[model samples]
Target: MIKLMKSTFYKEEETKKALANFILEAEMLSMGEECKKFEYGFAQKQGRAHALYVSSGSMANLVLIQALLNLGRLHRGDRVAVSSLTWATNIMPLIQLGLVPVVLDCEKETLNISSQTLQSVKATDIQALFITNALGFSGDMEQIRKWCSENEIIMLEDNCESLGSQVSGIKLGNFGLASTFSTFVGHHFSTVEGGMICTDDEELYDMLLMVRAHGWDRNLSAEKQRVIRDKNGIGDFFSRYTFYDLAFNARPTEIGGFLGNRQLQYWDEIVSTRENNFKRFQNCIESNDDFLSLDVRHMDVVSNFAMPAVCRTHESFEKYRKRFENAQVEIRPIIAGDMTKQPFYKKYVTNESLCENADFIHKNGFYFPNNPELTEEEIALLCDLLHK
Candidate 1:
């Protein structure tokens, strides 16, 4: 049976062996040098100034929102536009943190929010945009960036699904003021269950470190720690025990750091394999009349864990879903479809807007596996299934 993912890391057996030895020899298992090293490597590779390691992708979003609030970058009841096609956690932080969320619809072709989508918004109060680069595909991000800049909207990327994807020569995570990533088992990089928040803004970066673990400066650089401590008059007695701002316990274990380090070595190989699989999947789906053609010409790479098949109708969606299931191929509905329709969103948010495209995708979209480990035979089978 074809599964979403066959292993935890790119080289699972080897990674487990290494992890076993590391655990046996390590004097400490808490956040340490290993975590710092992973952060540095991730920041360098993603072309960002800072990358803060977190416990999970969901926590990454929470920490970012809390940091913004603590720094006075955002305030209670401030409107933040969220992509309607995103995962629940992407928009939950807004509702959870007392910020208003305005649902932004995505384009049908790109499976992402375009500048045109922003233009269609009648709401003039949006302070920020929490945009999700869905399924390793992005809209015309350059135009989106320009639009956001002109509108003075602070754009943040929920780039958890599009880690290695590049558009117009810039990585997906670099297109916004800051971005979040997942290093879950099946994501582009795996550290079992981990996340990262990347940004170039030093103020935001400093806030993120403090916010990750009970709002303490323990994780901050000496200079940042010194500055915060000095400002708060936190002397040697209370410095370590001081809790500065609103935050969470989103700290990653040293094990996550070690696994991240091990997985970082195979970033290129993993990304290349997934990109190639995406191309093959694209070719097959584009030729099928029942499935919607995905527009990805703007992307230099697509490093996704799964390939979506947006069928022409709900009946078609069921037919294809059944085909894959019968073939023992695992599949799931596209990223918590039409987030506005979610029960949690409806319960919390009052202002409603039509997201026709996102609603349509909810009824028609289902994604199949496109992991790096797909064998040539598995590819042929998946491709054959994509056909009529």
Candidate 2:
């Protein structure tokens, strides 16, 4: 049967062998030189000045939020606008850290919050826009970026789903001040389970380093570490045990780091395969009037997380769902559905604005597996399932 994740790693057998030898011969296995190497490599590759590796994508979100708070960029009661069509962790950190969330509805075509959505939203006083690049698709991000700059909004991207995606010659994650990524098994890049936060801002990057560890200056450069110690009057001996700010132990191990290094080699191959498959799937959808054709023409590349089919009606959704089920192809709801409909969100956040488009997509949408590992035969079967 076809599955959401076909394999654990891109070059599965080779990575496993290398990891076994590294573990057996290496003296240390905790977050060490390998993790640092991966961070440097990933930052350079992703076109960012700094990249902070974390334990999970969820931790990446939490750490970023904490770092923003520690730097006084975001406050306890400030309102942050987020796309209604996003994963739970994308919004959880906002609520968990005492920031009020204003859910912004997405466009039906792009499945992401467009600049038009920003103009239409009732919440005009939002301090930040925590936008999600949903299903490897983004809105008119260039115009959105200009609007954010003009309005003085702190924009951050939850780019977990769109690792290799690009728009207007710039990567999706680089559009915002800082962006977060997931390297879980099913994502575009896999490190078993890991995450990354990329930013060009050095001060925020340093704060993120402290937040990833125990709020210490251990991960910083020698000069920066000395500055923090001298400013806090923390001597060399006492600094080792000192906790300077509120933080969590979200550091990744060498295993994840090693796996990331191995996976980074095939970013181009993985992305191209997924983008080609997505185009084929899009062609099938265009011919089938039962499903809605997604708008991704503005995007230069789509490292699609999964091939989403949003039917025009619930009956149509059931029909397509049955076809995929009959073909042994797995499918699931689109990224945890609407954020406001989640139980955790409902329990914590009340008086939220209605997200009609997101709610509609939640009921009508299901995503087919579009991983880079899909064979030509599997692609044909998926395409057939998507048609009629």
TM-score of each: 0.98, 0.98
- Which regions of candidate 1 fall more than 4 Å away from where they truly are? none
Clashing pairs for model 2 are none
lDDT tens digits by residue: candidate 1, 130-219: 999998989999998998888888999999999899998899999899999999988988999999999999999989988998988887
Cα error, residue 172 of model 1, in Å, equals: 0.2
Tens-digit lDDT track of model 2 for 275-388? 898889899999999998899889899889798989999999999888888888889998766788789999999846788999889999999899988989999888888777
Clash statistics: count for each candidate:
0, 0
What lDDT score goes with residue 181 in model 2?
95
Note the residue pairs that clash in candidate 1: none
Model 2: lDDT of residue 61: 93
Off by over 4 Å in 2: 122-124
